[model samples]
Every structure is written in C-alpha cells, then in structure tokens.
Target: MKLDRTDRDIVAALQGGLPLVAAPYAQVAAELGMDEAALIDRLKAMKARGIIRRIAAAPNHYRLGMVANGMTVWDVDDAQVAELGALVGALPFVTHCYERPRALPDWPYNLFAMVHGSNRDEVEEKRARIADLLGGACRAHDILYSTRILKKTGLRLRRKG
Candidate 1:
C-alpha cells in the first residue's frame, strides 16, 4: 500500500524497534510529535495493509547465557518435512526450524533447524534428541556452530524517498 506522511513517520520510528519502557508507543508518539492513539491507529492500518508483518522482541541469546548455537540441517523425505519441521520448531532448544530449498551443488542441506543452549554439550544433546525424533525420515544432517555474531536488529520499514 502507498504510505502517507504519517505512515512513513511511523515506519521510520519502528525501524529502530520499540523502546523498552512502560509505554513504548507513547514514547514513540512523543518523539514523533504524534499522540499514542494516532500511532496505534496507523500501526493497525499498516498491519492490516500488510506493510507491517509483526512486532516482536529479538532477544539476545548469548547474553542470556545461551552461548552455544548450531544451525542443524537435515535432508528429510519431502513428504514428511513439513510435519517434522513443526515438531522440531516446538522443541524449546530448537529456536528455529524451517524448510528450505535444497542447497546448490556445493551445498546439500534441505531442512534447517536452529538449536541453542548454555554450552556445546547441551546443544549437542538437543541435536541428538531431534535426530531421534526424526528417525529414518532424516537422511543426513549436520550442525554448523556459530563462531561470531555480526549484527542483529529489527526490520527497517521506511526507504529514503
């Protein structure tokens, strides 16, 4: 949808994410010289129009002592991938699980799962549990542990105009 001036302002404010305060919307409203009710209305409209996908907290797993994280890839039967992906995503240690198109010639993973824990052993244990759950449906899998984090932030909605 074509955004108006107010919509553009709201998008720009949200690009940085909601402030951590008792009344974050109000704080944003104050900063943008708009009222909280107006901000809420615009956000609602933006969501309805599919301009805003979701509002969520991007937690810092490392700071929370979840130091070990692994992106586990699996090659599963195409028919069972969706069901198993859902099951994997339900696991607490499995932070992310989704289906991806098979990687190219150099890469061969299909299904992707993210497991995180306080340490490497814990992450490995989680991987084992996921493997047991998948049974023979999973043909092959591997874990790629994270070595460094570059950047993490919320989406930027507004484009220079």
Candidate 2:
C-alpha cells in the first residue's frame, strides 16, 4: 500500500516512539500537529495493513535493579511442550517465554524463558519452581547468564524524497 503524505508523516513522527506522559498519544499528536482522532485512525489503518506491529516499552532492567537474569532453556517433551510452555510463561518470575525450534541431537532445548531475580539464588529458586511445574514433561534444562549488558536499538529507515 502506498502511503500518502499524512501516513508518511505519522510514521516519521512516531518512529522515535510516543512521548512518556499520562496522555502519550495526545501529546504525540499535538507535537506532530495531527488531530488525535486522525492519528488514531492512521495508526489503526497502518496496523490493519501490517505496516506496523504493536508498540511496547523496553524497560531498563539494570536500572530497576533486576540485575540477576538468566536465559533458561528447557528440553520439554514434544507431546506436552506447548502446554508446559504456557504454564512456564504464566509464572511470576518469567518475564518472557516462548518455544524455539530444537537444534536436534546436539542442542535439544525447545522452550526458552527469560527468568529474572535480584540475585542468583532467587533465579535458582524460580528455576526450581519451573522444574516442579514441568514435572515429567521437562527432560532437562539449563540457565545461561549474560556476560555483559545487552544493547537494544530500534529499526532505522533511510528514505529520499
């Protein structure tokens, strides 16, 4: 779908993300000189057309003091992987959980979860809870910690008029 000036303008304006305030969308619309309703309509249309995905915030976990985190990889039984994955995802300690394609004989972990805590012991306790929940469905699991802080950046676009 070809985007007209208004569409392009909206995308460009929000590319940096909405302002942080009680009324973020309203504030953004005001800054972009767009009517709030028009901005909402344009965003809805863009989402419907698959031009934009959901908008979310990436919190600074380190600043929040959530320093202890591990990527917990689980080798779940194929027959019950999805069910067990949902349970793992619902855990309070799990910030993110999803199923990944197993690499087969060498690397057999199929479920990945981001577990966070204030320290290693807390992380391990959560891991134990996960294991208890998985029960027989969980074959084996491992936790991998980040050696350094991760840097995240938004996608960029280069365009010419």
Identify the leading candidate in terms of lDDT.
Answer: 1
TM-score of each candidate structure, all chains considered together = 0.85, 0.86
Q: List model 2 lDDT by residue over 1-161, tens digit each.
A: 78787777777777777787898888878987878887899899998998887667766677788888899999999999999999899998798999999997999999999988778898889989998999988888999986567665454544437
lDDT of 1 by residue, 1-161 (tens): 68888888888888878999999999999999988998998899889899888788777889999999899998888999999889989987776788989866756777899888899999889889999999999888899999877667866665667
Whole-model alpha-carbon lDDT for candidate 2: 0.84
- Over all chains combined, what TM-score does candidate 2 have? 0.86
TM-score between candidate 1 and the true structure = 0.85
State the local distance difference test value for candidate 1: 0.87
Top model by TM-score, which number?
A: 2
Candidate 1 weakest lDDT stretch, 10 residues: 150-159
Query: What's each prediction's clash count?
Result: 0, 0
